[model samples]
Target: MPAMRFFVFALSLAVTSPLLAEEAKPGSPPPERIVEQKIPPLTPPDHELDLLFAQLKKERNPQAARLIADRITSSLFYSGSATVDMLMGNARKATEEKRFGAALDFLDQITLLAPGYAEGWNARASLHYQMGNFPKAMADTAHVLKLEPRHLGALSGLAAVLSQSGRDQQALAALEAYLDRYPADRDAQKRAIDLMIKLDGQRT
Candidate 1:
């Protein structure tokens, strides 16, 4: 059977363990320690993003709320070029077909052509994750964050990779970051709660 990339968790960091490096903080001593510190639980710190998410949460119907959020999310994926759009469409079809190698080929072209586009980086990140190439996926995720720090999708993808890689605490923080922007993601909420329970158990 072909290998499958598994994504079962959410984005984040600034943890207190020696396992993963702490998130860089202002004047953080080299290799800062945050061991035993609880993960920070702040929402996505962007006013515009908060407002959009607020609007999404206020919708009465669940599907409607998802639709609104989807629309908002969709807008983030657009890259205003027909060629890039065509390449991206092809990449999407390849991914759906499980032709991962082909999908990666297309994604490579996308990043090559639109190095500044966050969607290209995000797409590549996702494809790498599906291939179970966590380090490469993470490198792309970093690029996405650099290009668009408000990208919850990228953050969520990062969290999934972290969680599956056995970095539960890092996964918890990343999920919190994702939920800060998308509190309506029920699956993520459940996973975050589960991680909290598991982490708590380890403490005693």
Candidate 2:
């Protein structure tokens, strides 16, 4: 009976102790509040662009490819920021004017402000290629592909740079990768055919 009474008392104390929290001291600071950040979902691209790519792949016509590629490029420029868009436009204008230095400056600003934007890197890559900076161009082209795997422009750029460097094997690999994503690409098919011939001849 005594042991049972002691057990009962202990159980009551255990249950009640949590309810009897110590009061904060008058001079003590208030408890800190926690905040949670909610990230928004990515927006989808225009369906028309998707359809255009599908058509472009099947047709393999240079004019069709150009139209679809332009649309795809336009779609990729959407960074959800107007400032980034403005900078991109400025960069394009400078590039057209052959002011590679000024174009690169604008692209640098866009990439710095929106590191996630693939177009900025892609634009820089074009400028680098124009200046015969093949290595830099390849690096940026790689980054653009990473940021947007569907960027046909970057894939083609990569293929061109690899070929220009006399790396036929690497060039073939790049074009093959592009074809994997776009099997009906006529230009890549032609390039691949030429590269295969070159590589096979070297083998003997």
Judge candidate 1 against the unseen true structure and give its global Cα lDDT, from 0 to 1: 0.74
Query: For candidate 2, which ten residues in a row score worst on lDDT?
Result: 9-18
Where does candidate 2 clash, by residue pair? none
Count backbone clashes in candidate 2: 0
lDDT of 2 by residue, 1-204 (tens): 232332232123210122333567999886464344433212235576568667666755566666666776677766776787788889999999999899999999987877777878888988999999998888788777666666777777877887998988777776776675566667788999999999999999
lDDT of 1 by residue, 1-204 (tens): 010112222122213333556577898677645346443321233465567677765665556767767866776666666778899999999999999999999999989977877888889999999898998998898777766665778878887888888988877877777666666778878999999999999998
Which parts of model 2 have CA positions greater than 4 angstroms off? Answer: 1-70
Give the Å shift of residue 40 in candidate 1.
38
Each candidate's root-mean-square deviation in Å? 17.0, 20.1
Look at candidate 1 and give me any clashing residue pairs.
Answer: 10-159, 10-175, 11-159, 11-174, 11-175, 12-174, 16-34, 16-35
